[model samples]
Target: MNDHDRTASEVAHSLSRRQALKVAGGSALAFAAGRVVPSGADAQTPPSQPADPMQIILPETGITLPTDEVTFRWVDSGDSKALFFRAYFDAFTQAHPNIKFDYLGLPWTEIAQVVPLGVRNGNAPDVFQVPQEIPIAEAVREGWVRPIDDLIPNFPAWQAGFPPVSFVEGVNVFNGRVYTFPRSTSRRAGIVNYFNRAYLEEAGYNPAETPLTWDTLRDAARKVTENGQGQYYGIILVGKQVGRWEQYVRNMGRLAGSSAGPDDIDYRTGEYVYTSDGYLAAIELLLALRDDGVVFPGSMSLNDPQARAQMPQGVAGMIFEGEFTLPIWVRDNPDFEFGVSPIPTPSASFTPMGYQNTGTNHQWLYAESKLPEVAAEIFTYLGSEAGQLAFVSITGGSDPSVFDSVNQRAPVDERMRTVYGIYEKYMRLCPDVRIKNPETSQVYLRLQRPTPSFGEIVQGIYTGQLEDPKQAMQDLQDRQDQALDEAIEAARRDGANVSRDDYVFPNWDPTTDYLESDYAELG
Candidate 1:
């Protein structure tokens, strides 16, 4: 049904409930009072309740403002494992005596469907958390939210804290303006290859010092497989979606060539190097592994969480994962000896491009809100060192450097340090073009389809769905062109000034390397 119709129906339901309650209790109340209460007057007036005070607190900085009371409506994603939202509310309320938080938690699955409805209904929260990947530009283009740049000055620093080539760009910016702040980040890297030292020794190989190349990895997999027989597999690949395939593709790229600099941009030319030969070579390598029987059965359907749980159980020796899996690793396999290293390249000549998988800052204000200044104040507080630290501490993540001093004693992890190193050295701040306008963002998503008919030609060769790679590639290119044309046309119809030149495809070639040799060199 249309939005208006749905809204009318909901209103009718609410009115019906109110009418039923009155009918059930009014007669008894009138008899007890010994008088007949006027129907219209009683119906028009409802008992008033005292307003709750707004409470605000900065957890990391230990700043408390309990006197300022405000009720915050938030989506309650049903995942019990995700305590970030609830923890944030509790921490804020406990610290601020004047500020009281009214939380409205909705199921995770309903979040996307409900958020827009909230905004339209004037029931939107002062602060809301969203996944880094949700399209924010669409919200802005429709005037569903306001630009937050004027409200938060430290936004640039928050944006710079992430690895530039990562998905942060897709999360924060919309139509040249920032809209949402990131809370976490993720990276797609090759499997964390672990070998059974005993098995490797029996196979006449030194597991600790083995070269971390695709060929060496495969060789080790073969040896490990001999020991497994029918009980265990030599390797496990969580190949459930394009996300899994991305890690394999990245690893293969390292073998084929080096990555283009993360800071490098050619928005006007749409000349991303990710489409280069190196990237294709990487895809080919992954396909080769799939064909070699090194990967476990049912790999294409297995997700990352299942793969992670299986590792400590000894179901597989290697698994590809992001940094968030560290906590689980420590919990399930405390005594399990493992080593952490950057994913390896094909050769010494190649430099692997790592993915930065974390959240970012790109909050926005509501231009049409009745409490614009108050909303701005809330957003400003969020960007403040005190505000950001509180968010980080509660969520078990790091805050932006601009807010670092707020939580001086917070524990640091090796993975975070490594991520920071990458951010400082090779990463660049991602442009906010995608979210600059809803139409453009929609076009970009359409262009990123993972099927051959939709411009993802490499899918055919990797999945063995096509015999002729060259023909498939050509077909994919044709599909991409058609999609781009359609996108451009749609944008024009929506009055958006988009063109082929506006797109920024990633470049994954070695010839353009310009990042400093090491993270230390970045300074």
Candidate 2:
């Protein structure tokens, strides 16, 4: 079969089959030019400049248009920082006079609260970034979203342009149909160590050139804290933002040997490894520093924004945060000098793992959208090579594209380049259970998390609320194990052919990406 036929077959086998896509008049050449003739423009008028500033990759072709003027609302947690939204949206409107946007660019914290409210009130944006609070699976199961295969023109050709795991089953594909794409690279996950260059210099260390070992990091925090003399501390964490604790543990846990995906379960053994040596050590290090009073004193009360804001003001010397911190600091506080490095591990030599899954987080096309075709076109644009380049250029490379080619081609500043280098040299992809067994994703959606959660457990332990850290971790593992068994049973009740074995990957390695060919061992 041809490439187009093969891609269509792959999409059909993904989650579920959908109606064949419909295409209207626009052509590849039309999208390549990123311009619109404006339904009634005079043939005499010269075409406008390219919609994509970089004008590299072709946008979507053969998109159908509405006869009357229409406005669609859009919301994303990253929009303000992404900046490309304004330019791309305006350019899209310029091409189609009848199309307009009612855009809402809010902080992720707010999006978390707003999304559920909007969905319940039937006012959710036509297109929106999936909130962290709701699992994408739950949204799909409840009919909050629809598959994009029927909306994006040329169902097969458009998706062919992305990388392998860009549209994995169970993550973005439900029942052999596509949903959304996670365009950001996992190599630049937020579990990173960002520091104040001035403070590190004062402590007689340069982390940018040589990353810190676990022990050295603790010592550095102590030194910086001591030198501050109550003026500034060595490190600050978002204790109030409970998720930060879990984020740190999971990302750094691999170094110690958690070897599982972010869910804290090691797929090799099909067991939750929260109490594993690596994960425990990561937690202990933070507690040890907090006990030594090296961590910022006011950390317990600070949220993400508050904590991140203090780093540049010299409230503390360091923060365990993600790539988002880069562009904001540069734009808002130009004078503050900072640097980012991978989160330190127990030993100087260590490995970090990243996983891809639809159940993770993604932007979705709402089921309630009256203009599904138009909404799909917007995401289609963002997912394009040219659109990705424009994003990199406008966002200052703070968030690199999923496609390596785009990251390489787009112009970036020194710090963004440094981040890309760090992700490339250090991060490794772990086994994705969803790829092996899409039904396993059903178990995840049904699984119930234990009380206090991962982050709260960390806070309770450090604040002297939860007494035994090891036991607490063990209890969490046990609770999750029970929940997994129950969820599996529930999935089976719904006619899903899945079992606990689906989560295990005997042939998996902690140091390398789990390839499609590796699934052969399961048989």
Candidate 3:
């Protein structure tokens, strides 16, 4: 059967021998050897008339663009980089005119609520960015999402461009089946400092030359705030989004020598690092800054968009965000001179920030979509060499591609280039317990999140709702430790082949990429 003719069930169904053969005999050629879009158009495939989008041929891909009338929807907590996705959806429609490519951008808070509701009502987008509030494993086990390994032609070729651990069993994969490909990478988000060049300079600091450390960040913010005299502030943040608190702490905490950094798991011991010394220090610094009254007075109520807009109007000196901040500033506040740097550390000396090797493992496809083929096609195309390259070129590295080849060739400004350098120099791939034991996915499904989660703890402490930061973190940590132990046991009882030992990695190194070969050494 032609791809456009399959039902959603058939589209997501496991690849049978016959289906495998069909995929092999069909469009495998498009993705191989880094050639998704044909550079040279063949004269034999003449152009179709433009009046009808269905009849239009994509000269670049050498594929006749047409399909049965279908509405393909995608949603995300959209960002500046979403421009690239919006454009791709339009082009995708041109390639398959029958596809009414509908894109929806919502705040992640709404998305967290919206996705599960949509899935329950059978009205979710064909593809939606994972809210992270709902565990992916639970979603997969409940039949809300299916494996993507069978969807693409020559899956291996498509997966190769991504770095090691891009897909992990307990993470983006479950039971040997991959669920999603990271359309973006972590380097693009929540690990960089966006500073107003003038404010930093007036405060007698060069952010680019002297990256903010815990103490220095405090001093700088205080000095800038004093200069503002209540008119503007030292920094603005999306205090309404609790996640930003944890992210900023993690970024700086990692830079200050936290073993876990952003991963939250210290690979060396395979344990949580919520109360790591660096993490505690980062919290103290933030608390001191807040006590200094350097934080914007209205920051607590503002969302990211509001803070981002306010920053250019001189409301604050800095924001710790991803690379995506640069482009929006360029577009909306072009005259606002600014600079970027790695997130501040607790101390002056640098410590490598660790990340799970998985790319931006945020988006996922809904299981019961009416246009699964079209959804799959969009994912396949984006991961393609052509798609990745176009993404960078169009977005100008607003949200970087996981593929380095594309980012290396991207046309972006100085700030993006500077931060990409920071990402390369400091980013290390941490160990994935999933590669050693896939059964941990069950543990995740069963694992209860500790009361007053990391974000909540940070918020509570920052806002004075929590009296003692260390005690609060330790309490949460203990709860998490106990919760994890209980979850592992429960999963084991449920016949999952997981053990508490599965989470331990005695030989793992914090400074290097934990590849399969590293895991093999254990065996």
Clashes per prediction? 49, 6, 0
The predicted structure with the larger lDDT, 1 or 3, is: 3
Clashing pairs in 3: none
lDDT values, one for every candidate? 0.45, 0.70, 0.69
- Quote the positional error of residue 117 for candidate 3 in Å: 2.4
Query: Of models 1 and 3, which has the larger TM-score?
Result: 3
Give the residue spans of candidate 2 off by over 4 A. 1-60, 66-70, 96-99, 357-361, 449-451
What's the CA error at residue 479 for candidate 3, in Å? Answer: 2.1
Q: CA RMSD for every model? A: 14.3, 9.9, 9.5
- Score every model by TM-score: 0.59, 0.84, 0.84
Where is the poorest 10-residue window by lDDT in model 1? 47-56
Model 1, range 65-144, lDDT digits (tens) per residue? 23445554433332211223343344344344455545443332245566666677876655554322244545555566
Cα displacement (angstroms), candidate 1, residue 101, comes to: 9.2
Error of 1 at 8 (Å): 38
- lDDT for each residue of candidate 3 in 217-298, tens digit (9 for 90 to 100): 8889999999988888788777877678878777777777777735487767767888988888888887887888999999
Candidate 2, residue 108: lDDT: 55
Cα TM-score of candidate 3: 0.84
